[model samples]
Target: MMRRFLAILLAAAVLLPSCLRHRPGDSGEATQQKDTVLPLGFLTDAYQVDSSRVRDGETFSGLMNRLGMGARDAYTLVQRCDSIFDVRRMRAGNDVEAYYSADSSGRRLEYVVYHNDRIRSTVFQCRDSICGWVYSRPVQKVRKIADVTIHNSLWNDMIDAGASPLLIVDLADVYAWTVNFFGLQEGDRFRVVYNQTESDGEVIRIDGIDFALYNSGSFSASAIRFDQGDGGNKYWNEKGESMRKAFLKAPLQFTRISSRFTYHRKHPITGKVRPHTAVDYAAPTGTPVHSIGDGTVTLCGWDGSGGGNRIRIRHMNGYETCYMHLSKYASGIRQGSRVAQGQVIGYVGSTGHSTGPHLDFRVWKDGTPIDPLKMISPPSEPLRSENLDSLGKLYQAYLDTLSAR
Candidate 1:
């Protein structure tokens, strides 16, 4: 049932240049182009996002090593962006794309995580778009068509693929929301088919994610994330379901549930309050804790053994989630870090007022702590109705393809 639910909901492609032209120009060396690059082909080898690709649950450092994406690349992707679409959990049924390499490594250097909700798609080519009012007047369309095939390096693949400038802009806007663009591997993943400018082939963009799939666990769960409210990169399910919750599911996916929220219970340490304010998630010495929503970091730094590495975030709706007793925070969870929801702010450990390694998870409302597991969450952003003109047909076609299989 979950597989059917996921497969039906999400999906998303690429190509490059040098794949065009009738002849490879017989010029000895000055202008001789070898292989006649495909209309669009792989720049680097493709790898599914499974255990073979992940170095850590939160990060996929090992995939970088094999794909030739070193520490610098990995660090850049991890530090700047909190959560990246790591390929370690990618399933074999998913797509793995690769575009050409501008560098000598011959890797599909530029990669992005494309979710078909169930099957993780991998496409090679341009993902970045440059936006500027390209024309004098504005134009509208009912249906859009974009068929791109590219060859050359990954960077060039995107260029030759004729990707729209607006799509690139949209990609950048949500770079922090889903996957990390900076720390791409030799063979990462990407897939898109957006609206483009007709004359002069000047591309605009496909405003946002019509439908996308993110791979995880045994079978991938379908997810379609897009933005709304002016220019916020708010992601949602294909049916416009919001993935953002009032509080994160268990602080982090890997950490174990140490304790549940209780109104009246004996305190493990002092045996006084009989009121447990937070639930604890147990983990190793340096597990990172994340900010559950978009808010200002109110407190950070060490506070003693009971609260070793304590950090707090004051949220928009007077709601807040707290992580207590950490070996350390993730760089800057300081006094004023403006963080989005689901962003990593610190690691897990035994810090303040605790025993062993664990994260004391707490949620607050009206400036008071509340049970995180109880609140109802809002839905994710949905695609604009105007944008859905071409979506129905496109979705049906993809569904036909899936059903046939």
Candidate 2:
């Protein structure tokens, strides 16, 4: 069971440019075209641009010194970059651009641009004054389609389909409330239509998922993105029901269930038959453990009953949950502390029990220990009647777009 769950956890890729543009700007490339804006808002025709990567163990001050700037000017430039862009963040191997004056035998450097990442950069002026400011490339949203069949696991299959791992994470988040990802079987398949934020023809991040369908031979679940004047977007099914539930399906994102709840079970360490009510999730140590539902921490301390570090939370409707063998509690989490659903409350660890790193999770209903896998959670509010037609139209439009492929 744990191996299959691990296989499921270890699981995109077509590029379809969307019609939406995030901001007004062209690709920051040095071009001969008139008025062409290079990086840092400098016109390519106005200056000679030299691009290079930051050498290993090179500092901003050292770069300036190598560029012929005096020590005092480099020091002042470093000081001005404090609040704008910390010089310490100028990581090695990152791209850097130096702008030189057009008509100069001196070959003097006027502006230096350091790429913080692919999308963000910092421009440092070094001609006469020492100042710096941050700049971000204009991002554009591109709709992408990923249709994959589960051969081994979602992770490996999606990767084999040329999809980004980031997209897999997003898809997992979209179905966090409903899908039993740990129970994914062979031949299962899914299709998703999502948006990717792109800059300079490269994906910056996943904007969001618009539509998704998971087919497991016997059951099919569809998620459609819709908004009904809630000032935020949400996912719903074809019947106008919300996809979000009161609690998440699991406490951790990607891990295998090492143990199941059973009355007749043998303890691994003790080698004795006993009732094991908790579901054991086996993951690496320090993996974040999240609260399945919103609640207040009732008990956050060590357990002397061989459970090790434990946290107990009381929820609504006479429901309570316990997380055992935590390596440590999340910051600000203690007795009486309020926690939101899906919030990280602790991390997976092997603190007290005789086993490797894992989270021992248990749930109770009216003071009776229950199986968490069998627990059913209430769904969020459905779409209002007035908004059903709008959702239908939007969902159909997405379907048409997806079906075109």
Candidate 3:
């Protein structure tokens, strides 16, 4: 009887193997099989990959020919990329890859991949007939929060709080119209929520700021990002007032007030006690000078009356702004040219009479010289009444988040 039971067990085990054999479409064993594709969508196991960086002055054709491809084949490959990409757009320090056959044929180059940027790449298939196509790698958007108190400079304080340069630039852009970055006090604080784009676990850039709160000892303001379906996104305050004003607080960044507007002031270089109607901002040479508001250029040339390279713009409401002591005028800035707010118009320099590198900025209201620092700029279009309710809730939530942090 024991022998009979052993024989039955052996027979059952042999039949079970046949019954469990994987069918053609069965999910049991086939589910484990996955295609090992590289980031460029090529089979990873099928090729031996070699990575390189595009050297300065390296052309696409030159790079392909250097990798053992014939000149004729390289030319053909370039022609195929006419609509796909511009070969001239390839830049130095960009990543590249050459895929060779793993088995034989002297490791023939079968494909080449060029990474255009952090997320975009172009793949060129070199088998028999060359073909090219552009591919974009999947990017992940990550939300980040930053809260910082200024003990030193804004740049240093934000960097110490693990904020990227790009992120800080975005934050500054949001407050350009309202805050004077040059006048930030030591105890000024900032809190913000923003998004960063990532590929391969590396942060590429700060996408945009969702909300921000800036507080000085005397004043406080909050910026909430809101879209009104007007094809552009804008930031607003809790009362639904637009944060973007008609003019930026200052023309350039990273500067200090060296001189203020006064009627009876002693000139430093000329030793003349005269009316200095303009505000002089001390900055290094070649610092970019931006237009404070949207206006048309009325004058862009060297001034013989002590102000060297000068640019005068006439804005709306009988307002005019002038920038003097510029080393050079920005391209496309000429007489009768229209410039937008924050557009770079010139560079700081010691071009005028008796001064180092500094910007002489002046503002006029109805042909009367006024203090640029004390000039009150009007805000942009406010939020529509229908959108105010939602914006209020969003602002409250963002304010709560900032306070909690």
Per-residue accuracy of model 3 over 1-405 as CA lDDT, tens digit each = 776665444433322110122112246534532222234434545678899999999988889987768889988877766777788898989989998875554777887888888767777877665777666655678998998889998888988988766777888789988888877888999998999988666779899999999999878988999999897548999989999999999998868999999999988977889999999999999999999999999999989998999999999999999999999999989999999999999999999694699999999999999999888999888899999999989988887876686
lDDT of 2 at 159: 80
Worst 10 residues of 2 by lDDT: 12-21
For model 3, which pairs clash? Answer: none
Cα misplacement distance, residue 323 of candidate 2 (Å): 0.8
Work out the TM-score per prediction. Answer: 0.42, 0.74, 0.74
Q: Which runs of model 2 end up more than 4 angstroms from their true locations?
A: 1-73, 79-114, 123-139
> Which one wins by lDDT: 1 or 3?
3
Per-residue C-alpha lDDT of model 1 across residues 1-405, encoded as one tens digit per residue? 775443323210122121121221145631433332222222123222322222233334544445445566655544433332334554444333323234465444444333323212322122232000000112233233222232333355556555553454444333323432332344443444333333223333354444433232232223334445567535544444444444444555434566878978766788776677787777887766767677888888777646777888887767776788877877656898888777888888876677688888788888777776665444445566764544445555644543453
Give per-model CA RMSD: 17.5, 11.0, 11.0
Give the 10-residue window scoring lowest on summed lDDT in candidate 3.
16-25
Model 2, span 278-386: residue lDDT tens = 8999999999999999999999999998888899999999999999999999999999999999999999889997479999999999999999988888888888899
Candidate 3 stretches greater than 4 Å from native: 1-58, 63-70, 80-84, 92-113, 123-137, 231-233, 253-275, 281-288, 354-357
Question: Would you list the rank order by TM-score, best first?
Answer: 2, 3, 1
Ranking by lDDT: 3, 2, 1
lDDT of 2 at 222: 89
